[model samples]
Target: MTDDLDTPVLDNHLHLDPRHGRGIDAVEDFVHLGGTHLLVVNKPSWHLGVEPDEPADFRPVFEETIDAVDAATEVLPGRAWPVLGVHPGLISRLVDERGFEPEAARDLMQGGLEVASEFVADGEALALKSGRPHYEVSDAVWDASNAVTRRAFELGAALDCAVQLHTEATEDLTDLAAVAEEVGLDPATVVKHYAEGRLAGVTPSVMSEKDRLERAAESGEPFLMETDFVDDPEKPGMVLGPKTVPRRVRWLVENGHDEAVRRAHVETPAAVYGIDTEATLE
Candidate 1:
């Protein structure tokens, strides 16, 4: 991601995962290359290094991170746009990953994310006295946790922000799609990673990911791509997806799927995340 590259890039989904530092340098490199703004995604509390003992203090610290990300915007091309904070995986994907009691993996994974604090607020606890709780954890915790996330998304969106999310299960990408619609995406602004339904239904023949990207052309939902590019031959346990996204991009460019690729970032995602830019090179 250098400034010298003529290709326009929109990094719609980079984790400001606090496990990582402020991405100021990376942001500058992209911007210098004539890249436009990024849609900064928030890390879920579970992803924060905070331990369980300090669980209760979680939401405030979550707030602080958003503040920090917002501050970075002042130095960006424009004030950087933010995604309201929440890890959709907190309730589903993360929980399953943690080896929690194998809850029914529905449209999304279940069990929810780890928390830094136990729920203590009385009124906040009251909201979930009934059924169908939305909190990633128990009913008692849902109120406050849900509030923090809602507020983060609200503030970010009000600022014309875009939300970045990780789907809980591999097949849950469509659910993320549904969530984007619910968030009132304006187009091209919504972003989901590891999308393209490569992992839609794990099997033997679904092995060729590039083939899957070609198949996904019909659905036309937009996506973003990134690479930690981790390839460990010893860890065949890891997903095979790392090889796919960039290949898909080049494939799009080669096969005139650039319009399809561009739609995922600029138009469809922009509308979903409320982005004002076209995500194209000027």
Candidate 2:
């Protein structure tokens, strides 16, 4: 096992579901592993077998995520930020299970994002989270998903907060950038979560892949690191463990790539998220 790095790393993305394992323990472990900060992305209600007939019904998921982030901050104060959104996958779930019409699903997603925008405006959240179009869905559904995601970008522009995007692998981001630009959001404000390979005009919050990390390092590109840790007791370490980002940073430092580690785990995330690394780690 790799030891933690001297410079604490920040996990740009992670999901700490209280319904699964111990949320507090997860936060403690992340902090102990030299993780200086993180963003908690909550699962949508459809995953929990709940179909929302009203926009207010989505409130619980957002509240739960906010509470989780608050709890994590209390455990490791100033290290947690809340990220809430209507995930793109939720649209498929709503249609497949709840029999929501395409337009209805789209409307619901738009409404949920409006609520997320409200959270940003009210200072309840630091940013909005949403995913781009899914390839598996039909063209109509894909169009709707893209439209909702565009709405998220619009909200982000108005609120001056970043938008964390969940997109498919090998996606062409030029169009997304154009969409955000059209909505008045700078391309840099769209963070591509679970990112693989380098992308232009958007910040790639990479999963903990050594080869990908090394490649990004070689280019000296600014990016963020994440474990994408889904704390599900059943699946255990689904994407990567809570300590993965710190260990990756330590590994990079040992391999004479400390500068890259610093850029990914410290510089990029702080700039994109508007966090003061010194104050956060203190």
Candidate 3:
């Protein structure tokens, strides 16, 4: 079943927060659909409804993320990878919803990211997920959000780990990369999550769209493919189904673009996360 596609997919972004869907079954189902690797992200304030005061407060969230990935790895072994961090959206939530002061929120977020960076250093997770300037917040919150996000990148640089970005749809990447470089983090390690358009230096984790996939394939751009499956039962398959990336890979192969599938699904993720695809499958 896994070899049917001949090019196994590495789902770079997925949420298995237990509150959203059947935890281990979703992973097994994704594996059955020809997915070989999964980067499971933890959503603290988003899914778990937790507020951050200090970095230690985020340890429980990171531990939960580790437990989820460990459970999946128990089922699928090396195929499960964890991505732990304070999601950018949480910045706004803390400021606006929880009535937290901007500085306090920023401090909490930075502390949480410090904890995530430790996990990355310990090899328990691959990346610290954070991004600049969630566009929907108020002006003050937006400014504070970008400040905290910048600190996360600096933490990544200090820890020598990758950072996964979640920002607006039309956000620019050059400025983000500049921030990364200024903080001593390599721009190449910064991944734009749920990306739609092309960028100059940053790597995008694209969804399964014919035009988007074709453009990425034709441009010879270095990018990874993902479904960004939220796995929420209420809005099941909202962004895309679990099999979306595998189906898109099949579509590409059928259309005589097998090499593109290999680059996007296999080579790129392996290089980015430094994981062995075959070892994961085994």
Top TM-score prediction, candidate number:
2
lDDT for each residue of candidate 3 in 73-186, tens digit (9 for 90 to 100): 776634678998888777777887888987787788888888888898898998889875547677777777778779878988888777888887753588888888999988
Q: How accurate is candidate 3 locally (lDDT)?
A: 0.77
Q: Write model 2 residue lDDT over 37-78, tens digit each, in one string.
A: 778887666654557877777788888888888888887634
Where model 1 places Cα greater than 4 Å from the true spot, the runs are 1-8, 17-22, 32-34, 46-56, 71-79, 88-165, 172-192, 197-221, 224-251, 279-282
Model 3 poorest ten-residue lDDT run: 43-52
Q: Each model's TM-score?
A: 0.48, 0.93, 0.92
Q: Sort by TM-score, best first: what order?
A: 2, 3, 1
Please state the error at residue 267 of candidate 1 in Å.
0.6
Cα deviation at 98, candidate 3, in Å, is 1.7
Better of 1 and 3 by lDDT: 3
Note the clash tally of each candidate: 28, 0, 0
Query: In terms of TM-score, which candidate is stronger, 1 or 2?
Result: 2
**Winner by TM-score between candidate 3 and candidate 1:** 3
Please give, for residues 1-282, the per-residue lDDT of candidate 1 as tens digits. 343322334444443433355346545544554445454544444556532222243456345545645655655554444433335434334333543332222112111111211111211110000012233455433433344333333333444444333433344434333433455532233343544444332110122256555655444544444432222334333453232333445555678676656664456444554444543234
Best by lDDT: 2
Better of 1 and 2 by lDDT: 2
